[model samples]
Target: MDKNKFIKDNFGISDKTLKLVSEAEESIKEQFKHIENICEINQLRVMKAFADNRVSDSHFVATTGYGYDDLGRDTLDRVYADIMGAEDALVRHNFISGTHTISTALFAVLRPNDILVSITGKPYDTLEEVIGIQGEAGNGSLKDFGVKYVQIDLKHDGTPDLEQIKFTLTHMNVKAITIQRSKGYGWRPTYSAKDIGALIEFVKEISPETICIVDNCYGEFVETEEPTAYGADLIAGSLIKNPGGGLAPTGGYIAGKQKYVELCAYRLTSVGIGKEAGASLGFNRQMYQGLFMAPHVVSQALKAAVLCSAVFEKLGFEVDPKPNEIRHDIIQSIKFGDPDKVTAFCQGIQKGAPVDSFVTPEPWDMPGYSSQVIMAAGAFVQGASIELSADAPIKPPYIAYMQGGLTYESAKLGIMVAADKMLRKE
Candidate 1:
């Protein structure tokens, strides 16, 4: 069967939107051409890292106690470090989530008297709790630990507020500065690697001693360059989000300068038993294979994000970083303006999922977030954003966050289903 027919039969896509999807076919192909260049550059980098680390079939075997001399784990860390152009890296299966890895890094380098500044406005929701910006400060947050936190909001045009950054850097005894490359739940545009590089240069010129860390969850492999290549002191991301290729069960990674990475490792394990102590527990094969496939998987997701933006824009809804704009992350946001539309859109997405298709999603008070959120994630692996998923918060303007498509086809079909349902209501 043809692509359009298959979509119509399977997802019940409307005739009007089917034409829109068909019209978008050529444009999606054209956009993917640019993505091919990005994938090509990143593929070469991944291959070089693997080759330099001498990755072999034997490296896939797991180790048990203490994991000393675990070649697979060591090589994965080395390859990650090399690909990011970092001095060293600490990649392990022990770090629970992206927030855990980021928290470890913060606690490692920051002291009670030293200040931590975020120049990219407030960070993601979970980071607010971790940084002590919300919730109880008694949960051993940075604020409770006596580490001062300051944030600089972006300008009206959505660029970083540089004047405030300079003022903060010149006066405060700032220990580290954080740049969130992804847009998170905000409506702001995602920062490209080149843009992040400029920010890194600006910070260095003001205070060369300050550590610059990037929360690099959904931004990996979307561009040929990464924040680490542009002189970020440290970068952190979750394996389940991007680097896992939708295969890693659970984990996160932090890669950067040898001293900083070592500090994070020390915090992850112990001072004397840093990276050498974590057991691979039979996940070496998936982690290694996942890294090898990450570039291709990330490209698929990027194409889907562009497609989502285009489709939503055509439907008279607001979309951030329109389809034709330069993209640095896979997330695409669309404003629906009504709670009923939000529910219908999410249910439509869930209906197209490969798993849990019979279930319905509803808004509820989810932890780590201020608002009630409804999430539709029917992934082969639980909570894997690298697969097709959509989420939204129950608040004013009612925007839905869509991200991750393991394959471009899955993402395309899912969006068509949601758009069909949403447009039918009109």
Candidate 2:
């Protein structure tokens, strides 16, 4: 009969769940308006960047060997820097992953005996090795490079302990302050651009010279404003995450102050080579087209996250940032007390995928984390979170973090299927 009726009949949704979905649908409509406003702003940004750079068909051509004077690559960096309100930007396929991009930024800024303070507490698990907090000897981590590391744990509610942060900044040779915009694998709130802006101001007040960096993965394009707008010295993220728009094959970006980005470029290639050296190869087309499509893709993913939160919360699962809550990032987490249910949830997501549907996912000791992790990502691009994926580290809370949906419809299907499968298991 109607759309709701069709969904209800086909998905075998319970009356209770349908009622919750009805409320969610209403809430989502209001949220859509907010996203629409953001999209408009972002659209203007993309159009302006293109117009300013005079992006042409020739700009999309691939380059090889040093990629010197690669107009497309240079313009792409300009567009990224323009959109992010940064002085400069370096977008390169050479920066392997989000972790690697962040590492390059950190290393570019911090020197031997300089103190690097993480005001957001311990960063994503993958960075521990990069920071020399973990990993084997002679890896030449930040710690190994003689840069001291310190962390100020967030309060229970995920707010940084300002007193601790101030104390840490004042007492040591705090050269840089890092604020992670995403929750990472933790069950904490993601920092909004506004939140990070305030933190930047606070740091500037404490030490005007100390540089501030934002680990910006999974948080871009979700907000109307970026951390760079509010004084962040550098913001780093993977192209495979939100910025890629499901098109970029492999890459990451670092954007912010010109001098800082210059240092990162130096670290990326060599001191003299800098940003001029990296070859775009053939990624120019995808990078250009993907960035233009990013705002729309990111909006779709955000809507999917809201839907996932609503659906799972209705099923009596603990959901982070309930569906109606203001979203700073695209991630939605559902806690399953039992690790079996966690695995089942992820498996259900994989089952619903358009790709790799026949394959099953299992929890294993994934390389970057302390706990065994199970991930369900049947993305067209490898590890692309801009498509539907559900993953979680097997731990006490056993929460599955789900993010990315290229389209609202695909994500709805995936979340509903996962809910159906998990409910059946229950």
Candidate 3:
């Protein structure tokens, strides 16, 4: 049977949808090639990190109990540190999620009187409770612990407000500041590595004592240089995102200067038992393999994001960082005005998934979010955004956030599936 017929018979993709996918791909060949170039540079960096750390069968052995003297765990930390251009690193499945890792980094460095300012305005929705900006106090939030929080909104053009940042840091006794490298739930464009580096320099020039932290969840390997290369004190993210390469079942990492990473490690375990306490359990190989594959996987995601923008923009919907733009993260947002359209698009994405394709995703009040979120992810690992997923908050200016594609081919089909359902009414 023809490939188009196969898709139509097996998945119900319309001929129009298949034609749209082809046109979108044809228009973005240059962008796809550009992603490949980035992948090549990043691949070299990962391979060198592994080889330099002497990764071998010995480093793949899993330990149990206290995990003391776990060669694999320790060596992998070194590998991650090298890749991040940081002095030290803490990588472990104990982190649970990206937000957890970020919270740990904040708690590790902040004290009762220390003021923590977010230069990127507000952070992702999940951080609202953690920062004590939302939810009840006395739950060990930053505010509950007496840590002051300040925010500087981005400019109307979506760039960082450097002038305001300088003014804020000039006189304030700021102890620490954070930069969210990814767009998160915002419609703003993601900051590139060079952009982040300049921000770090500006902040350091004004407030030399302030510790700089970056939430690097979806931005890893998107560029050759990470925030650490620009002198970030600490960078944290979830293993289920970019760095996991869609293979790590569960984990997170914080890589940066030795002092901060050591502090975070202590927080992850205990004061006396830093990185030495957590056992690799049975996940050593998967984590290592995931890092090895991350560069290529990230490229697949970038390509998908570009194609998604191309198709959505051509259809007269609003898209952030249009298809021709250089992306700093993997997420692609499409503004859908109607709630029903949001549901149909999400369900279409779910249908293209390899797992749970028969199931329809629906909106629910998921924890840690301000709004009811409808998430569609048919992934091998639950909630792994690296494997073709779309999620949206069912509200005004309802925009769907689509990301992750372990393979470009899979993501292309998923986009087509979504387009078919989304345009059915018209």
Candidate 4:
């Protein structure tokens, strides 16, 4: 009762809303143990990587200018590679975003006339233009550069079409295949690390020369193992998403085979300046510290996601990864089925934010997406997905993809606040 009062008084949630949330949480408590188990395994792996890399205070030294021979920058790369179980990694605060990092990796692995296969069907919305599928010509996109691209749609059950993939491999001179481990903007279940590994193996058997790259975005550190552990040639992701633990202001990472990482490094910088020139700009410590805290923070976000599923399921809404289902990423997809409800839900999320509680969010044409979007995020770091935030395309079905929670407590309040606004309208 006292806890309910605290939530009601502080967050302005009605008692009815609180009761609903409380009931939702009680039903989902069993899911927390599984999340914690994965967290523990990943936490140990990260610690082991840090220790094996012999990290010291000197590795935190800031660098400027050409950033030549910067121990901090280079050692951090080694640490990241170790964490991902890859031969090498190019970790820098310089890579713009997850999409930017993935683009670089894609460009590095493929040349003109080489065919690129997306085994995971269409990628995230931002990558559409980057892949030259939905953008103007002569923009230096892959399509502009004469690189061919194809995709194999997942079956209705959300499983890969192995026969189609095998036939495609045999018929086409495929150079590389991209595996998006997370379900981006799609209602499909996120692929598990083991599941990804099986797919990589399947592809390798058919075409040993074809490189396999995993879009390791929101899926990072969620499972006990990364795709690299299962024989991925390369993996790319945004630091601000999961590995940052909500502390890294900005950046991205690409880790995998040494040759691919080295090529990506060349693309990130210049040919010869690869992995050697980027200045850490004093962000090394935050990166290091954030990574160390990632597992625990991810667990919190996972808990929040699970709770969202449980609450919305109880409310008779359609949700992917039904309550108590194992999560491969932090994202919780809730189908509200109405644009007005989507706006209200996001606005309520803003009100629950620590940074901008007074603001109301409205839908707008966000860059890199096809539809006008409504986003509810008031994070300390702009565009930081690891903090509590939600965004929806504001189109048919009106599904809201909510993710991130620095701490479970804050995320719970945010969910409660969003629920209050949603229920008030009903």
Candidate 1 Cα misplacement greater than 4 A, ranges: none
TM-score attained by model 4 = 0.98
Between candidates 1 and 4, which one is better according to lDDT?
4
TM-score of 2: 0.95
Winner by lDDT between candidate 4 and candidate 3: 3
> Tens-digit lDDT track for model 1 on 288-311?
888888999999999988988888
Cα-based TM-score, every candidate: 0.97, 0.95, 0.98, 0.98
Which residue pairs show collisions in model 1?
none
> 169, model 3: CA deviation in Å?
1.1
Which model scores highest in lDDT?
Answer: 3
The runs of at least 3 residues in candidate 3 whose Cα sits more than 4 Å from the true structure, single-residue gaps closed, are none
Model 3 clash number: 0
Scored against the true structure, residue 45 in model 4 reaches a CA lDDT of 94
What C-alpha lDDT do the candidate models reach, one value each? 0.88, 0.88, 0.91, 0.90
Q: lDDT of model 3 at residue 291?
A: 94
RMSD of 2: 2.0
For residues 199-258, could you state the per-residue lDDT of candidate 2 as single tens digits? 999999989999999999999999877899999999999998898888989999999999
